[model samples]
Target: MATMCLLNICLVLLFSTEIYSLDCKMLHLQQNKVNMKSLELLSKMGGQFPLQCLNENRNVGFLQKVLRPTESQKENAKLIILEIFQQIFNIFSKNLTQAAWDRSFIQSFQNGLYQQIEQLEKCLHSERENEIPYLGNEKILFPLLKLKKYFERIGDFLKEKQYSLCAWETIRWEMERCLLFVDQLTERLQN
Candidate 1:
């Protein structure tokens, strides 16, 4: 009878261990899926913005004339910012493993993002008063600011060692917000 009781207890412990391992694996997989989807969305949105900006100005003869003097500089700044986004997306795509969420990696990413934000701020500051109407009335600035804030939150997560889906979700939300604003501005410009 004691032997049977010992056998049952052993089996129960083994089964419970297996179940716990399976649960952890599933959670990790879910987190990975969320990260990939978020990164992909960010990549698409980041790539779209520069193209949309270029397209919006294709037929704007009046606006072009007004912005002619500073056009190249403005466009170059936008392209630089776009390149930063592309680089960030590349990093996220390639480093899809759990190590990517490590403190060192997150710190490096945060620094790069902050640099890009500074460049963007400079670009926005350089815009002349007359360029405001053509640039969607400074609608782009808000999204960029919000994105920086979200990145900071991600940095916080890293510092806390809390690599939850919440950080990625926040980033995804900010990216969507930026994309929506850009899309609306593009539509307005097109019309």
Candidate 2:
């Protein structure tokens, strides 16, 4: 019995130490603004956080392609914001794992992005003749402006080495706000 208990204790310690080591490495990489490839690798290695990937430099070509359908400058501005949201989603979804997913977390994240997408779609569909206005010019521009701050906060959290909890919270906050903004826009257009 004594030997068996000792073996279990040793295994637990070893696994915990391994997890801590991996988290430390992730913290280091996140702080450095490591490239996307490295971020992907760390995420694949069972890292639960997603702050590193979402904050990368925008892909100009991808943004242009995604926004090519819009003709009006105002609509195009909306598309630009949408494109950024999509990029953040792509990065975030790629990094998450089953263990990282909580129902509350996923629902909150999904709802936020869905809301933003809905808003943009509504504006595009409803404002057929009138200029929809650039997002920067919108009456409720505070939401998108808040999103920019979330991105910065995520970056700052990574910099501060709050790898495990802060990073996840940052991701959650960004997703929630973005979705809400989109949802508001969509609902407005439909009515």
Candidate 3:
């Protein structure tokens, strides 16, 4: 009887340890997935923004002439921002199954993102100065600024390790709002 009890206790301990380890691994994987999804969404914005700019067919020639001098700077900023996003995505992709949680890395990346947003904003503002009086610059700038805010919120949640469903839904809502503006702007530009 004593021997049987001892065996059962050992078995239970062994099984519990295995289960705990498995749970930890699963949690790590979930975290990685969330991070990767966020990065992918951010990267998509880079392409979407330029496409929106190009969709302004009527302003293409005039705006081009006005922006030609600083065009390279604008493009360079967008490319750099996109590259950074891709780099982060690649890192997350490579270690999808592992938990490479580094607070410093996330902080640095967030700061870089903010810097890029500022740079882009400045470029847009400069272009706005030469925009035709009737063209409402707010249509573009407002959505961009809103997207930046959403990114900041997402980054904060990521840094705090808060991946709640509600948080993600809120981010999604913000994204949709920005996209709606983009669609509206595209329509306006088309007309």
Candidate 4:
């Protein structure tokens, strides 16, 4: 009897995850407009990054390799996207206010990004705080590791530039690319 009850619980979880997944996919589809607005606001905030920073550098293309098309396990991709957003959110939290960049704009940008993060978190399950999610699966772990380095390199760049306006500007460009990929991944989530 207990085994049958356990099976029923598992089935319910499976169905709920699917329903949540559908909602998450739709959420991303709807988010494109909102994300474009945020990006436009960011551009208004700063775009005068230094010339050297604009030199088609190595780090700019790291994301393409890391966030490839969704494979058999769309959930893994979702988790990676979640991790990516969390990392960017942290970067913004730590450095955005340092330069006194337009107070209202900053608040609005953070709020929009925070809302998206919350929506994604609502639909996904993982013990993603300290440890990596899906640890044993090399396929899943690979992208997570690559993205970790990508965000870390962004940190390194910011530190090298003393987190100046130009540095934040470059980071803004990078963040835009990350969100675009997030959109792609969310669209590719299984129906």
Candidate 5:
């Protein structure tokens, strides 16, 4: 039942990346930890998700509409970016408890996600004496609210399946897409 409200900012400055040019690719280059390019690793060691996992909880194009590059998206880029990460954290964390998996698999993803989230958060806080403001403009707000519902649906779906291996498999599939989307967004992100 964990939710991803803004966590406390890690006061350390060196952990930050530029908000305008978040280099997720750089995250993968770390020699000793889980690579952020998880899709590459997963694909290399390929296995198909169960057939039951194939029927996805459709997002009604809300995710596309939000992430689609537009003037409005540009204006509210920071909030959109944060929202994406928040959703990722929420799903990934929920899966940690709801889905039983090998310890190494779950822990690695959790650690990688936390590191990425904290880096973004630290960057957002770099200019401010306090936390980043929780903005509420409709441009991002509506889509974010929509995305939130989609994520909640995912959580509900997980419970509905009694946290089956297939249920977790479906979630893992979704999360792979989510993380890949984040990586793509990181490439194009601008101030």
Candidate 6:
């Protein structure tokens, strides 16, 4: 009777451990799926978002209220810009490295992104809309320029050893600080 009880207990423990490991594996897979979906949505939205902004319903209305183009908005826009770059960085890291460069895709992605950032900078500068200067006379142009430079460096870094992780880490670190700065600016704007 004692031997039977021990065997049952061991079997139960083993079964529970297997179940937990399976659950963890499933969770990780689901997380990857979600991330992939997000990246896909971003890619689609990248093309559509600017176009949507052009519609009459999009202009001079409640969006201005919700969007609230303050200094904080500019800052937040910068953060989102960085987030977009980081996502691209992650994609590159997953697929390309010192051994291989996804040159065509990277170039195209960066070009599109560069154009979008330029348009956003222009949007910030244009006085026709409810635009505000970001951080004194710097405007939104400075951050866009900086981000452009980073992309250029990333391209150069792709040729070097162990640079895949390094390139991603560099942008990732800056992105956090950018978020914090934007959050502070946002708080001030809210007040």
Most lDDT-accurate candidate: 4
- lDDT tens digits, residues 89-117, model 1? 44344323333233333433333343334
For model 2, how does the per-residue alpha-carbon lDDT over 9-87 read when each residue is reduced to its tens digit?
3454345434433432232222122122222333333344455646643222222222222221332345545654554
After superposition, candidate 6 runs with Cα above 4 Å error:
1-99, 128-132, 137-191
Better of 3 and 4 by lDDT: 4
lDDT of 6 by residue, 24-52 (tens): 22322322332333333334322222332
Error of 3 at 68 (Å): 26
With a 3 Å backbone cut-off (N, CA, C), the pairs that clash in candidate 6 are none
Whole-model lDDT values for every prediction: 0.37, 0.41, 0.35, 0.65, 0.52, 0.38
Candidate 4 or 5, higher lDDT? 4
Top-scoring candidate (TM-score):
4
What C-alpha lDDT, on a 0 to 100 scale, does residue 75 get in candidate 3? 23
What TM-score would each prediction reach against the true structure? 0.27, 0.32, 0.26, 0.69, 0.64, 0.30
- How far residue 12's Cα lies from its native spot in candidate 1, in Å, is 53
Clashing pairs in 4: none
lDDT of 3 by residue, 47-101 (tens): 2333322332221112122222232233232322333333333333332122223
Query: What RMSD does model 2 have?
Result: 18.1
- Per-residue lDDT for 1-191 in model 5, tens only? 11111121222212443331265334323211222534543332225765665675543234554455552344354455566667766766664554445444444444445555665565556534574454545666776776687677777877777767767676666666765655545544433
What's the true lDDT of residue 15 in model 6?
50
Worst 10 residues of 1 by lDDT: 57-66
Model 4 agreement with the true structure over 70-180: per-residue lDDT tens digits: 442565756776787788778888766445466555555666566556667775643355555577888878788888888888888788777876677778877877777
